[model samples]
Target: MDAGGEEAKQERHLVLAHKLFLLSHPDLDDLAKVALRSDALDAVKSDGMAPLFESLAAAGVLEPDDALLAEMRARIDEEVRKLDEKIADAEENLGESEVREAHLAKSLYFMRVGEKEKALEQLKVTEGKTVAVGQKMDLVFYTLQIGLFYMDFDLISKSIDKAKNLFEEGGDWERKNRLKVYEGLYFMATRNFKKAASLFLDSISTFTTYELFPYDTFVFYTVITSIITLDRVSLKQKVVDAPEILAVIGKVPHLSEFLNSLYNCQYKSFFVAFSGMTEQIKLDRYLQPHFRYYMREVRTVVYSQFLESYKSVTMEAMAAAFGVTVDFIDQELSRFIAAGKLHCKIDKVAGVLETNRPDARNAFYQATIKQGDFLLNRIQKLSRVIDL
Candidate 1:
């Protein structure tokens, strides 16, 4: 065999071994291209070439000797499509959670595709215990495909909830980042810039901290789209100035579209800042002070912000966000209303206080309540002054 044909044979050999990438990974294409090269294939031993061979086979670029490997991939892909169709049918016929069959089939496919470890952690162990082997979220191997479909269809809200449930049920950071990207997507869709920023920051922090690959760029795409969507100059400026945020944007081809709307060329100061303070300034600035503060303080700060924001918040948004039966939120809200800590009478609900002072007892709770109870736990403590 000539050199090129020999290299192609080697690639096919690797593919037959089930060690190749089954699909193109947009995130690691640069690193991945090296593995796809004939030179790279020639450098590796037979065992070491497995992943590369798998990629070549999946790409259909390998030699044709590995009919068995091609057959296996075809079978796996067929089962994946069947499971996807089953999921769609289950959703149409039955109600929620009826698609466990599809999850199981996809789970097996994922396992066969060399994503078994990723599948194992994502498999719903508790649910799997109740159901037999062939169906469960944990058993679903085609999650990544489903996830991408959800993203493509712009069903961000439903997608986020489903992915999050999967994550909380013990899906690893790989799945979590998928949900995080969706969360950012939700904010982007709703035009809620700040929430998008927070979601993106959280995604970057978690993905970087975990050292996971391929997904880091995905979440950043969500953030970039969000920034461009934002009408506010501050939002655009903040993200563009941030280098961790900028690198992903720089990598993507969509930068030119934003230039007319965002004049990013003028920001030389941000560019200088990017080179200088990047290590200290993370993708976001919000989390640093808290990590410096006591852990308990973070929850308190969040709750305080929530309560402050709650005063002017309408029952509608609160109900949707907390995902409660509406009556529950409304009922509890009445209690907060009665206590005077929350004033619901304002004509506006889009904005509210960011914090509350705990020192002044009379600012709220003018209404009399029975003393010696937890009625005003959030109410400011009273100060006593006696002339001696």
Candidate 2:
């Protein structure tokens, strides 16, 4: 073969090798090296491999050397500028390749700087384009990624539905797992802890079985949802006792402390630990929505435990112990009492909350009445059946 042909063949081999390595390996350092080498060999101005480099840079896999990163960014910007010119010049049909590359460049840059809305806006440019199957899939994934990064649950749901329609036969396992993760996140955002926990556990199983890199995230969410839902046994079984989860939990001290306090039933300690990490928790996009509700649920558990331990406690003492105003305690207790969640009576004049246990006689009478109602309903159903 001619020298030019041989060099082209070599470039193709390198790009293919790099893509294969990314598919199999989860090591960022190794992937960075492959991406750099591939970019060096394919030294074209508007290289198609820009997306691959963009992915690595966004993931922080590239070297932290500022000079190198700056150069990379400059080149990407130049390429995108050229693509914009080409798009503007085309009258009828914008070339698919040029449009996709421009979209990817702008979206990646916006995402790197945490401008999720701009990233999403860039993605929308290609929404109505006539693209190949692979590009269509990329658009779907990018839409979902931007939606998730910004905690846009509505957009996330729409993207998932679009993905389902685009790949109706269920696509690959990786895509299915990604959809499951988003579904779980939606449930988490909506405060449906039980359903969220179940979906996260399923995603964790899929990730573990596939040896995926992001199973840790699913594990963390599973534990968080389980805790809020008061399913400590499941949390222990699915997270605390699992070796994989244990390994990852050590990396997040806040989570570890929260779990420890929960397991030990140190309600005050748990709140203290959580309060200390409030700023950090608020910064997490996925966890922010659940913060206020989870705190309220934890407080409920603490109050219920306190009530169980005392026949009658002064509202002032309870408020002081919980570090809240007496009025606040009164309001919360009133809510619980009205909802029938707490079997207690508040004596406003005495400023005491008196615990009430079900009397055996009253319980027996209620059970008898319930059984009679059930029998009457069954007889009515049988009478209707006979007439039919």
Candidate 3:
């Protein structure tokens, strides 16, 4: 063989060996360390394995270096440029389908580098093209991902609707499960906690049946949203106590502690657990939208419990129990009272909040009105029947 052929063979062998090594070492960090030590990455560099390098960078197995990243990006850009030219040539000779595949591959590369806008532009080209069910699913997946990352609920909803039909028709169980997750995320974004929690729970079951990516993320959302939307008993029965969920919860200590506090009604403990992770919760893409609402719901539960336990509690004592200032407690109490959530009277001067149970007279009046409405409806129906 010529020297060029011999060099190509060596590069191919090196790439194969690298793949085998990665397969043997499941841990990306461990593989990265070994690959670096053995000069395996260097051997494969000649083959222009941009995707491999990109994966390493994404996995944090390769430390961040600005110059190195820029160089890699430049190389990938050059490769994409070449591919664009090939795609143009193939459009006439190869076929439209082949050209669409090229566009998708390029779009994927852009997506990996976080250039979602460019990826989206590429996806737009392939959107209405005739493609296989699997390719159609890929299109839908990327569309939803772009919509979600950008916080465009309309786009996300549209993508889900489009994919739902395809997945249902194709009977793609795995992708359908993924669609559930995206739907859950959409509901969460919209602040529909009940629907979001239910969808997450259903998705968790599907995930258990067929191992899915980002399993731990789904578990976190499921636990947090369930706490907000479900009572203690329902949460325990459906989520916290589930064996599959428990296994996943073991991986997230913060979530585990939060769940424990919520289940035990340890208000102070729950606050501490939640406050410690406040920044992380805010930064999470999926959790940020619901965090404030969840916190309010938790406080409502805690305050309601307090009201039930005591006929009247001083603002100072309430503040102390909740680890907040008296002024904060007063303000929250006023807001709750205004919203009719807390049936209580607040004495600003005395700094006491007096709980007011529903008056028996008011209950009787409400029941009487409800019964009168029912009787009126029955009489009208009977009159109509007699006329008939």
Q: lDDT per prediction?
A: 0.43, 0.63, 0.70
lDDT of 2 at 326: 93
For model 2, residues 2-84, the per-residue Cα lDDT tens digits are 32433343323223433433433433366566665455434322343344445544666443344554565676577567756
Q: Candidate 2: misplaced stretches above 4 Å? A: 1-81, 84-138, 149-151, 165-168, 205-220, 305-341, 346-388
Q: After superposition, how far is residue 14 of candidate 1 from its true place, in Å?
A: 17
Name the runs in model 3 displaced over 4 angstroms. Answer: 1-81, 88-100, 110-118, 208-213, 289-291, 308-331, 347-353, 357-388
Candidate 1 local Cα displacement, residue 241, angstroms: 3.9
lDDT of 3 by residue, 1-388 (tens): 1324333433233234334344344334664556553464453254444555566556764444556656766887797898798778778788887888777777776655456577788787776564678778878777776675456788888888888788766846777777787788788878887898998898776763121225665677788778778876788799878886887686665788778876776667877878865655564655565767667776676678677778888888878876778888888888888888788899988888898978799999999999999999999999999999
Top model by lDDT, which number? Answer: 3
Per residue, candidate 1 scores C-alpha lDDT tens digits across 1-388 of 1224333433232233222232232333555555554443453232233333465656665543365455555666676678779877976897555665555555554544544344444345324433432233323323433333223334335545555565555656555554554456445445454676667766654543111123434444444444434444655554545555555554433342333223333233323432332322222222222222222322232223345434345545555554454566556555555555443442334422222335356734543444525545534343222321
Cα lDDT of model 2 overall? Answer: 0.63
Best by TM-score: 3
Which residue ranges in model 1 land beyond 4 Å of their true spot? 1-60, 66-110, 114-126, 130-142, 145-160, 164-178, 182-223, 243-388
TM-score head-to-head 1 vs 2, winner:
2
Comparing candidate 1 with candidate 2, which one achieves the higher lDDT?
Answer: 2
Q: Residue 79 deviation, candidate 1, in Å?
A: 18
